[model samples]
Target: MNVVEVKGTELEDAFQIRREVFVEEQGVPLQDEFDGYDESGAAARHILVYYEDQPAATGRLRWLGDTAKLERICVRAAMRKFGLGSVVVKSLEKIAQEEGFCKAKIHAQTQAQNFYERLGYRQTSEEFMEDGISHIVMERTI
Candidate 1:
């Protein structure tokens, strides 16, 4: 498995992975799963994790002013055992740090809070619902 920065057509693979996991599987609406950020000129940085040349996971980070917001993280269900989610987070964080971002945050689904906690993220907000799913805001210093 390998994780790397993606652009242009390569981002289609990222979107597909996200759609499979978030929209089709998790029931998130298409309108919520996709936004204008995927457009050619968006400031978001997308990352794709491929195993055997097939996209297995994906994520993105974008500047919300000085903070890097990590979003859209998803790993193929079949590839979850490989710890690809952590790999994707670390990769995104590296990119954020390289870009001079000292802080990173994510609206983490409640079920995945422990995963982010293990990676040094701390919950910063009360649990809330986003798109009908329980979530909480988390942050970490990269």
Candidate 2:
């Protein structure tokens, strides 16, 4: 498996992975699944993970002041057991730290809270609704 920074037309692969996991599988609205931040020239840095040359996971990094916001993290269901999710998060964290950010945050789905916790993120907020799903804010210093 390998992670690559993708932009322009290359972003299509990332979007496909997100659509499969977040839209088709999770029921997120098409409009909500995509946003202006995905467009070219946006400040966000998108990452794609490929296993055997096939896209397996994707996420993006955006800055919120001094904090790195990790968003759209999703792994292909079949690839979940391969730890691609962790690879995506670690890659984003590494990118954020290299860019001078000391903190990173994610709005983690309630069901996946434990996964993030295992990675050293601690919950900082009560459960809340985001895009019609239960989620909570998690933070970690990278």
Candidate 3:
């Protein structure tokens, strides 16, 4: 398995995975999925996880002051059992550290809160709704 950093048109695979997981599978609106920061050149880094050369997961990281905001993490439904989700998050944290970020944070869906916790993220806020799904903020020092 390998996680790759992408930019410009190279982001298509990452976007495709996100659309598959967050939009079609989870019912998150398409508009809410691609939130425009990618086009803004905000220095956000996008990553794609490939398993046996097949794109199976994706995520992105953007600097938020002193912390790195981790978002859009998703593993293809068929690929979830292979531990690609952890691969994506670990890869993102590596990128964050490479970019001088010492902390990482996320707005994780309630159902996946435990998964994030296992990855060392601690809940930082009460449950909240985003795109009609319950979520909570989590953070960890990377």
Candidate 4:
């Protein structure tokens, strides 16, 4: 497994994984699944994870004041069994730390609350609807 910072043509690999997992599988609207944060000049870093040279997962990290917001994290259905989701989160956390961020946050889908908890994140807000799915804010020190 390998994770790399990507942009330009290589960034398309990350978008493809997101479309497969978020837009196609999760029913998230195409318009909501993407936004200005994905642009090349946006204040965000995107990462693509590869398993045996195939893109398996992707995530985005955006700095918001003192916190690093981890977003759009998803793994291809076929790659879910390999624990790539944790890898994606940890990689993003590492990047945040490297960038001088001391805190990290995620708006986690309720279905994955336990997953984030297992990685040391604690729920910081009540469940709320986001993109029509129940989600809660989670935070942890990076």
Which candidate ranks first by TM-score, i.e. highest?
2
lDDT of 4 by residue, 28-95 (tens): 99999999989887889999999999999999999899999999999999889999999999999999
Model 1 CA deviation exceeding 4 Å by range: none
lDDT of each residue in 82-110, candidate 3, tens digit only: 99999999999999999899999999999
Candidate 4 lowest-lDDT run of ten = 4-13
C-alpha TM-scores of all predictions: 0.97, 0.99, 0.96, 0.98
Ranking by TM-score: 2, 4, 1, 3
Better of 1 and 3 by lDDT: 1
Between candidates 2 and 3, the one scoring higher on lDDT is 2
| Candidate 4 pairs with clashing backbones | none
Question: Over the stretch 90-120, how does candidate 1's per-residue lDDT look in tens digits?
Answer: 9999999999999999999999999999999
Go through the candidates in order and give the clash count of each. Answer: 0, 0, 0, 0
Cα lDDT for residue 35, candidate 4:
96
CA deviation > 4 Å runs, candidate 4: none
What lDDT would candidate 1 get against the real structure? 0.93
- For candidate 1, the TM-score is 0.97
lDDT per residue, candidate 2, 13-58, as tens digits?
9999999999999999999999999999999999999999899999
- RMSD score of candidate 4 (Å): 0.6
Global lDDT of each candidate? 0.93, 0.96, 0.91, 0.95
